[model samples]
Target: MSNDTAAQPAYFIAHITVDDVEGYRNYEKGFFPVLKPSGARFVTYDDNVTVLEGERESGRTIMIEFPSEEALMTWWDSPEYRELAKVRQAAVTTHSVTIVHSLPPR
Candidate 1:
């Protein structure tokens, strides 16, 4: 068969750090459902990492993948989610939400 994965949807990765793991976990529990309505999914929320050439860490990291740019924007712009953003901001010291198209398909 020919390659069928060419038609799959892409993703946006959010490489972030949280100062308080407990607070972040609470935020995730609360906000995760909010994101699902906008087609956001947690591909990997890994805490274990090896920092080779980056700032020293004291917070947790997150990686979220959206289906597409439009979908990511949908969640980002949604009023419902916007209101809840403070929870995340307070929970984490800093966060870098980056959007990149997923390679191939997932």
Candidate 2:
């Protein structure tokens, strides 16, 4: 199966709380290269987040859209991302990553 082909579109969403701001910056810088080959596009990155309801709140919210689940997984499991994840792990105190599928266009 090709990287671009999948049953549906997939999105990666992350809610993060950074413990080391400077270290997080470094992680952001290193992330671009890791994302480039994965064909993932940034949907949003908001540091100033407002919690409307839930008990859980994060310092930042990020969303990335991918062509397919396969491509998303390929990127997530790739060596480049694995190495970069170390930087993210060190910088953030807490985070949640989720994968969601998009509904087909009408």
Candidate 3:
């Protein structure tokens, strides 16, 4: 693909607090399948996360890296993911999701 199509890498961050563990587990089961096809990589996922500095939301924090913004959006907007999201929405008490562009290499 051309550079324009292949663009810069992107990352997705989500801070979530689960109210229903079983329901969240169900969401987890279907998470990979939707992400795998879009080449998303799990950078980190931690429930026992600590705040080194500044304000941090309460809950499990997850960071996922994608090959590009397009890939990230594709995975997020996919029909499979949409279905899985309902499970996530029903399970979590708080959910914050954001996409960030990676800095260019020096």
Can you tell me which runs of candidate 1 are displaced by over 4 Å? 1-10, 52-56, 103-106
Model 2 alpha-carbon drift over 4 Å, by segment:
1-7, 104-106
Candidate 2: minimum summed lDDT over ten consecutive residues — where? 1-10
**Reference-based lDDT, each prediction:** 0.67, 0.86, 0.86
lDDT of each residue in 61-100, candidate 2, tens digit only: 8999987898899999999999989989999965689999
Q: 17-73, model 1: which lDDT tens digit per residue?
A: 666778777777878678888666777766676788967555445667766666777
For candidate 2, give the lDDT of residue 95: 65
**Superposed model 3: Cα runs more than 4 Å off:** 1-6, 104-106
Better of 2 and 3 by lDDT: 3
**Candidate 3 RMSD to the real structure:** 2.4
lDDT of 2 at 72: 94
Would you list the clashing residue pairs of candidate 3?
A: none
lDDT, candidate 3, 3-101, per-residue tens: 765678898989999999999999999888778899878899998887888887678989999999888888888888989999999999656789887
Q: What is the lDDT of residue 56 in candidate 3?
A: 74
